[model samples]
Target: MFEAMIDPTAGPSATAAGPPRAGRPERLDGLVVGLVANPKKNAEPFLDAVGELLAAEHGTAGVVRTRKTSITDPIPPATLDELVRRCDVVLIGVGDCGSCSAAAVADGIAFEGAGVPAAVICTDAFRVSADAMARLQGSPGYAYVTTAHPLAPLDADAVRERARLALPELVELLTSAVPVAAR
Candidate 1:
């Protein structure tokens, strides 16, 4: 019975072809930031704080917030299209668990493929799952931000602190123009 169990993370038999990663912008000034949040505990507040920081310090024009239907599901194509059309750069996150980490990474890849720079935030503990999902999505070595582990247990203030700590990497991911090969 134990041998019959399959390891889903063993690696995909064939990687799905994803879109070309979008080029990063030189700056965030007057750019519209998009925030995609899963329904996990503290995810929204964390994103809210990040959005606030971007608006206050980065000269972002505004923010558009959206919620995913489930942590394990991908963002619908239509919603992804809408975000690509409306946002200059997008931030997605709160991937504190395995499934959600994969999903969040997938979401970030999707946004990048659609020609929007995306920053994915996940807990450091789930970095393996996130990296696996990136490879499964044909985006191996995709860059994302990681906060301290056990993010779901954090209170509002704690979550905000994590967001603040994560802000620098998030900004770099969104604004740096490193070639995809280097990522």
Candidate 2:
């Protein structure tokens, strides 16, 4: 008797449709939520509030938050690795300015490639930049939520308001694969 075999490495169908994604869990309940913030003004406070809400509404187990050293740079590899290791889903925030938003999108791409789910948050002012970064990363229409523009100068209460206004969008991005909205 003879048997025939085929190599597993042969076709387009064998490849993934898009960038790698950490498997999305069925429930956010009791999952450790991570927040990675760009260190632009007001960025930390905004993420802190968002963390509070995620815990309140999502049954999140715990929060782990960190910030990139600069707004326009990729997070250090060590930090990125730690985030992937420690959290179930990461909410990335305050891609508020041009360079900063681009950097956030880039980080999102990297996180996806590393098998960690990440939601990129940018302000309306830099949607174009975020879109461009997504294209550069080969997920051109990747969806990210937009808050009102000019996040840097807002006071704590105003930033909290913006964070509040952005919660629904945040939840949507965190839960689903949204296509880029028409500008």
For each candidate, what is the lDDT? 0.84, 0.76
Per model, how many backbone clashes are there? 0, 0
In model 2, the runs with Cα more than 4 Å from the true position are: 1-18, 177-183
lDDT of 1: 0.84
Best by lDDT: 1
lDDT of 1 by residue, 61-176 (tens): 99999998688878878889999999999999889898888888888888987889999988988988888888877778888888888988888889889999989888988888
lDDT of 1 at 67: 95
**Predicted candidate 2, C-alpha RMSD:** 10.5
Task: Name the top TM-score candidate.
Answer: 1
